[model samples]
Target: MSGGTWIAVDGGQSTTRARASWTTEDAAVAGFIQTTDGFAAVAANVSAALAAVPDAPGTIDRLVVGHTGLPIDHASRDRLARMLLADHPVREVVLAPDEVTAHAGALGGPGVVSAVGTGCVTLAVDAEGRGHRIDGWGFLFGDAGSAFSIGRAALEAALRSDDGRNPPSSLVAAVHEVFGGSPRDATWALYQMTDRIDRVARFAPRVIEEAEHDAAAAAIVRHAAEELAHACATAAEALPGIDRVAVTGRLIAPGSRLEREFIDALAARAAHLLTVPSAGSPLDGAARIAADGPSIYRPLVEILTRPESSAA
Candidate 1:
């Protein structure tokens, strides 16, 4: 197993990826190959990712993965673990949620990372290595701060306004503009598909923009940030050693007013807000796990702190 290859599989709600790297006594090559939405679509991309990595040079030993949207129960994690072990000759496999890799990639020392994208999750880790999470619930129950959640909320608000039942939202106007001045067009597009999380989430940025100029939109943004911050605080409390908080996601794009408000709320709570040098991609963190194992959390600090790189 010494001098053997290391493999990593990162399964995300929106995408999945796999990579392999050979190690020496020095640094590793940024040998990331490709990214895929295989796990979400079908098995073909996953098979291709697996074929990309040759068997380990010596005896194949370990495989590590961070899977987003995986069932939180032991039976589910165990089943995925069995699949990895069965598919390859690796001696050991570690199966954990994507939040673990996000924490490893974003938080340094002791801090909380609120990740908001297609979904939202807050992860915290203390110096003692204990971890905590909050608001990782899927779109239906929670995900209050997620892109999908915000977009869904905006749609509901817009529809109510359109129906003359509820007050109008800037979201309606913004969405109307996006769909050629017809909110009905947008509605039809959203309703045309049963699985529209991604399509709806595409409206979040416009919602945020309108929120900056409209009171109703601003209210939604404020409420969303508050919900996200609360989730981060919950994780922080569980990790008493954490004094800093970091926020990441396309929703909180750098220098955006929403991100500014999120930072202000964290400051009000006395949580030092630090910039997490953009969490490049989950696959990068998964590769880190493959090369260094779970205990190598500290070294990940370097990867997360480096200047933002293109998504792997």
Candidate 2:
């Protein structure tokens, strides 16, 4: 097997992280770089990430990229691989969806995993290695248990309360305080924001804080927890004989109400599963894939080493 420098990248919606490592028989050196280009501009983002590595591109042996919004079709994957290899001189490259790396990093084996942050997604891998994905439809239609969802719910409730369509709550006052205007003015201000999804998601922490003393806010948080738990349960069911589940993302951070409510909801479902926190970051999983070659995503990864070896 070949052993040299390798780069691993975990590109997500909000931030992109890359790690460059030089490995020998018994030791390794590593460095990290972070960017905000996200998956929408994956090509440019990846190029920037690669350039951040301390070592020259020609000296790198391999690069494994697990990216959000990665194309699923083989043709598209090949096109992307070509684009990346055009500028860098890495010997081999492997690419797959970010969830594959998340699953590997969170569960490491056969189990279900729920990743909740700006968005939420649940993935399950059975003992037989069959994979199932639940939700993660993005901010517009899905991501039910995500921070974006919670923040949107809070904003809607505040708006409804202002219009006399819902009961008055602390959220209404909080919104008025933060946005600083009448309902119409607040609406106008929101529309002016460049990144509305991220701006709206900023209210998630406020929702959690208010939920400690407000009924409406508490209900929103609990419902979000229920939604996340349900996704986990559904995925677990799809992957039979799996009794372990891992939860990641900032929404369910330790010592938070969201985490407590999520656990309680799971317990209510009588799910005979061992729920645990993730052991490593997605970049770690990407590194593992680079070192060991493909595993679960063997069919999805494209190896762009030789000119003729372009397909997965």
- Measured against the true structure, the TM-scores of the candidates, in listed sequence, are 0.77, 0.84
Model 1: weakest 10-residue lDDT segment is: 302-311
Best by lDDT: 2
Question: What does candidate 2's lDDT look like per residue over 181-205, in tens digits?
Answer: 7555776788886566666777788
Candidate 2 regions with alpha-carbon error over 4 angstroms = 1-3, 22-40, 176-186, 297-302, 308-312
Model 1: clashing residue pairs? none
At residue 298, candidate 2 shows an lDDT of 66
| RMSD to the hidden true structure, all candidates | 8.3, 5.1
Give the Å shift of residue 123 in candidate 1: 1.5
The digit string of per-residue lDDT tens for model 1 on 6-115 reads 67666545555677675322222212212353233223334445665654565345566666545455665555555555556566666656777766666534677777
